[model samples]
Target: MELWMGFYLVSFLNIARCVPESSYTVHLNKLSFEKAQNYCKPGSFLTNIPNEKEMAKILKTIWDENSKTDTSFWIGLKKDKGICVEQHLTLKGFHWTVDNSTQSDFKTWKVEPPVTCAILRCGLLSVEYSHSGAKSNGFMDTTCRNEHAFICKRNIQLECPRPEILSSHDMIEPKNDPYTREIVCRSGARFNLTCSKDLVWTVAGNENVDISQLCLECNKGYRRDASGNCADVDECKESKPCEHECQNTEGSYKCLHSYNGNDINEPPQPPTTTLKNRGNSVQTQPTSPPDDVRTNETVLHIDESAGDISNIVVPAIIALLIFIVLLVIVAAIVKGCLRRRSIKLARRKAEAVALNGSSSMEKVNEKEET
Candidate 1:
């Protein structure tokens, strides 16, 4: 299949904002629905016109670009069952199609078919001009054999030039501020916008909007981050959802817990054996693993080894403290014994000196009498 790549800039102006968006080029060549699907880019396919609003947009696009003819263009819708299908798509008994750009269940058929059949399979859209030159557009079904100009659609990711967002990320103040300018945003970027007075923020041509809300909030599970950008909350980091292990996912978290090496949420139950009576004796039948040893999920339970260690460590610490106290008492007793022995030796030396001095004095007095 041949592949074609082209880029175009489309202006997206809603009630509260003006955004510059990137889009794929519409193939002006004439081809059937199957051929149009084949000629689309690698990541693209035949354009899908699912709803009235998108149908109007596609009609406007064709009228603005190709002024040569007002021929019908083939869309991605096709007849799958008794009902019309969009791009041969079905899910859970629902009829819809998601092109690279948008998804919708809206159909703008000029007249409802009395009975649907295989002959009317593919869908066709055209922009017809009235007698007063007013444009009228609608969708119709036809066979897939006919050739017509078709539109190819693919997703476009456009980054804004540069945007100046408020520090607080409050939409109310900015929507009413006079200095607010056109804020550039990337493709598919969402923002919270609020209305100042009575004007409601809705699609350009859509009238069934609730004006009482006054604010178009971002989708649930998304909030402003530190960078003032709306992003999904990382439940793992924000709330620590898991008891042991938590893995962050896009808008959710995977709670993971393991007991030893087993990661399953619940352990397998142990089998039970029954004793059968054989008239005079009872026989025990072997079963699966024992229940006491089979259950390994002990994540929230305390470890027996930890209790054993504490049981041994606390007594050891007390014994060591007692030993130190006994060693200190023994050292004090030895010091007291040595002090008493030194005092006894000093007293003996003094007594011996006094006795020796008396004997010398007696000898000297006898020598003087002679």
Candidate 2:
């Protein structure tokens, strides 16, 4: 049971893994703390300089020679509810330096303490004066009103931008599988599309894609044809994926069983399945149609109508059994009610007889006295 279960579980899980694309952007225009917040979209805000790594990236990429003229940039961090801590600013037991509602211990405060002024609540990245000139460099605290260039960060859905060559030549649109990123170039022409770092273009149709390569073959349960098109492997054509019957899906296959005049579409539950004591391997033997009369090796003798009949018959049998049980219960209840009514009627008749007898005796006695 466990062996068969593990097989399909692992197979499906392989394809379930995919690369989630996320990216960040930088804005060059200068804006104050309040203005920067308003300029960003609803989900995004002024860049939160959480750790040294991200701070380094911003300096390397966005803070260029042009930034030397105007050094400092506004960051997302601000004093919450006018509460400020001299040492570590902890908010409600969580560090407020991180953004996106996530917590991180990383902090890059400058050697000097932040400005003591209560109004200077906003965060800033101070630039150093190098031989060239002012350089966008490190972290500092500044007033919210201070006018400085700000950086905005947001999560974005990353996609391989369609190649310019295809658009210039008026070629058909490339079909991309979002899961595996297996791209089928237009007009059956194989275009070598390479993904950026941390992403790879896989063969696509499979449930799992190889993230390490530029472009690779389709994974198990799928294969590419002469035209380099990926399609589901037909496990049923060769033999059954299951013990009794095989049903092929888009990228995978299903096993089926027929028992008690019903078709059960579940794997690991093969009819006439015998578990061997050695290695716990499951062995299934064909029950219907004697093996001696079988001629075609590939084809199994299966009644297609049996599957249809099983679907209807199984439900009907269940309903009939339920009705029979309910009828028995109702009959027993009626019998008990009639027995109780009969006992009460007998008690009333005895009481009436005793009263009649007593009245007759009294009348006879009065007649004698008269």
Candidate 3:
């Protein structure tokens, strides 16, 4: 029984080895502070050296991987000091100023002490060992430039659940198969199940079933063709189905009607005239006007001619009469003026004669008095 148990344990170990393992790796590169933060984003932890518990796990992983201890690796601790210190520490030969300075809580110092005048290097700290009662003093400092090993936590491998097999009494056996059982009904056919765990169960006699024919449903905005395939259905191709024009869209179609033409609902077209044919035979009608209408029409034409004559001749006659009347009035006024001038001259002469007579009489009376 002991030997059998040992053999069983060995077989289980071998089976476990045969199962695939799920693991991932992280690469170290010249990453900025932001990039390093992104690398540890969700599902990953930033490697820290000062945490004793976490450092122990990291050290185990590093040992298991046979990675070098001297190689430098990054850590979550950042240089939180002022920019002045950062610049001072980054400048070569200026590290002497920081040498012997008190270590900062957030900043991890290098394992190997830097030269007094050397530039300070930044990196993550890894704890090499753990001490009891107090904080672990096993922290090791590595240069930020050094490439070293790191650890990543992941979920353990899971085994797929084994499908339960039914006994003959419990199984619904297919009519054609005594060993196989029907599992699922699909398209008037039964899916058969066997004892194979890895292989998927399939229909017993449908090994050559055309899968393309099985999936004949058309996609959205498409219709099934005669060949059981999807084809684009142009809704616009249907005559006057849309108010204006139809546009095809994914899974559906749309009618586009715009108030861009005479009719918003109808598509614009060039002007056309519609004429109906009475018959194939042609007929000629009389061109002459009817007797009664012809006489009335002639009268209307004569009246129009008379109106045209009045429009031209009446204005000319009125103008000529006005000119002649104006000339006659001027002549009469000139004649009247000449006659009045003659009468005035005659009256003046008579007055002069009367004055002369009076003057002679006055002279005679004066001479007699003398």
Best candidate (score: lDDT): 2
Taking every candidate in turn, the Cα RMSD to the unseen true structure, in Å, is: 26.3, 24.3, 27.9
The best candidate by TM-score is: 2
TM-score of 3: 0.22
lDDT of 3 by residue, 79-142 (tens): 3233223323322111111122323323333343334323334444343423331122232433
Model 2 weakest 10-residue run by lDDT: 165-174
Kindly provide the TM-score of model 1 when superposed on the true structure, using C-alpha atoms: 0.31
By lDDT, the candidates rank as: 2, 1, 3
- Write down the lDDT that model 3 would get: 0.44
Instruction: Compose the digit string of candidate 1's lDDT tens values, residues 161-222.
Output: 22234222323224333222322233223333322112233222233433222223445656
Once fitted onto the true fold, the runs of candidate 2 whose alpha carbons sit more than 4 angstroms away are 1-22, 63-66, 89-105, 111-120, 129-137, 156-370
Q: Which residue runs of candidate 3 sit more than 4 Å off their true CA positions?
A: 1-34, 83-121, 126-370
Minimum summed lDDT over a 10-residue window in model 1 is located at 1-10
Model 2 global lDDT (CA atoms, 0 to 1): 0.54
Stretches of model 1 off by over 4 angstroms after superposition: 1-24, 50-53, 81-106, 117-120, 130-134, 157-370
Shift in Å, residue 19, candidate 2:
4.3
Compared with the true structure, all predictions reach lDDT values of: 0.52, 0.54, 0.44
Tens-digit lDDT track for model 2 on 1-370?
9999999899877655543322334556777778977776543456665555666666655545344565677767666434544665422222233343434344545543443434436667666656544444455665678787776654334444443332112323323333222333333334333443223343333314333222245677776553345667788886654556677776666655655454453223333745576878777675455567432223333436535678898999999999999999999999999999778766655665577776755664564469
Q: Which is superior by TM-score, 1 or 2?
A: 2
